[model samples]
Target: MVSKHVKRNYRIVRYVLYKETLLNTREHVWSFLGAFCGIGLLATCQGVWQDERLTVLLIGSFGASSVLVFGAIQSPYAQPRNLIGGHVLSAVIGVACQQLLGADTWYAAAFAVALAIIGMQYSKTVHPPGGATALIAVIGGPQIVAMGWWYVLMPVLVGALVLLVVALVFNNLTADRAYPTSGRFTRIIRRRQQGGRGE
Candidate 1:
């Protein structure tokens, strides 16, 4: 009695949510711990270390990074190289665009993100947070720019390092979890060299 389209939709939903769904309480504990640590550190730093107000973007980055890194631990997307390189590259590109593009607002924002993504791809360090880094740079006020590249090193790099360090410890604590993939791509390259067909 089921229509074909309805059957297809049901299958899609099941597949999408099936294995990835967190039915186990242990899974929730690990995932939440990663996310909480990242955000908590950032939040604590806001008032004590720096007077800057926490923006939605920074908060979102902290939360999303945790999810990407811990929640999907096996994914190449969350690897340490991708996490740090992507952000650093984007930060540099953003500063360069701000200097060269002359604050055209929308143009700078758009181009910085696009360019940063392209750069990341070429560098083989594609991470989701890099986009935000670029956007931050383009729209960042004079004070941010005045920080003169040190801003990238201080808050961005330092924050990411702290989050990553915490994830490394917490993720590896459980027998089932592994933190910051060691060298997946290297293994793949070795396989390819040995004639393992991959497309």
Candidate 2:
């Protein structure tokens, strides 16, 4: 006789393996397009706005965010609130850590990331890329250090918005892919469509 615990363990193993073994080409294509457009838009902005006083429109953390927001659209971390709030909050913490501890020390970077994680958790917007966003503020060189509070507005918030917009558009192009699995906006849109059909 199989014990219930053993059976449950076997089922879990099977589920994990099954998920890994499956291939979804359609899903991959959409993820690719979404990530490409999201990052490409930021890159284009950086190129267009380059000048004597360079505005940093692109940040490395956005690459990690692209993986979640586009490739793993259904994840809670990839949602609009998480994507935007996490980056913005983390950037604020990062800037504060740099200011308080001085960006030159390694501990400042560690402290920035650690505090950012706590901030995200407490705020209910735990996006993994936010850790990197915090670290970047500490070690991102003179340009970023110089930006100070402005970092939250430009590359962090602006870049996050761009990614969110692209994810919302491309992820909805296919019937199977929904950028946000559930949200008030989705409900409102559906209700309006139903009303329009009745009319």
Highest-TM-score candidate = 2
Error at 107, model 1, angstroms: 1.3
lDDT of 2 by residue, 46-151 (tens): 9999772346988999999999988888889999999999999999999999999999998999999999999999999999999999999889999999999989
C-alpha RMSD values across all candidates: 7.7, 3.5
The C-alpha local distance difference test score for the whole of candidate 2 amounts to: 0.89
Q: How many residue pairs clash in each candidate?
A: 0, 0
Q: What is the TM-score of each predicted model, taking all chains together?
A: 0.78, 0.85
For candidate 2, give the lDDT of residue 184: 80
Off by over 4 Å in 1: 1-6, 17-22, 51-60, 183-199
Clashing residue pairs in candidate 1 (N, C-alpha, C atoms within 3 angstroms) = none
Q: Write down the lDDT of every candidate, Cα atoms only.
A: 0.74, 0.89
Candidate 1 lDDT by residue in tens digits, 38-125: 7787777665654432222242355666778878878887889888888888888888887788555688888989999999999999
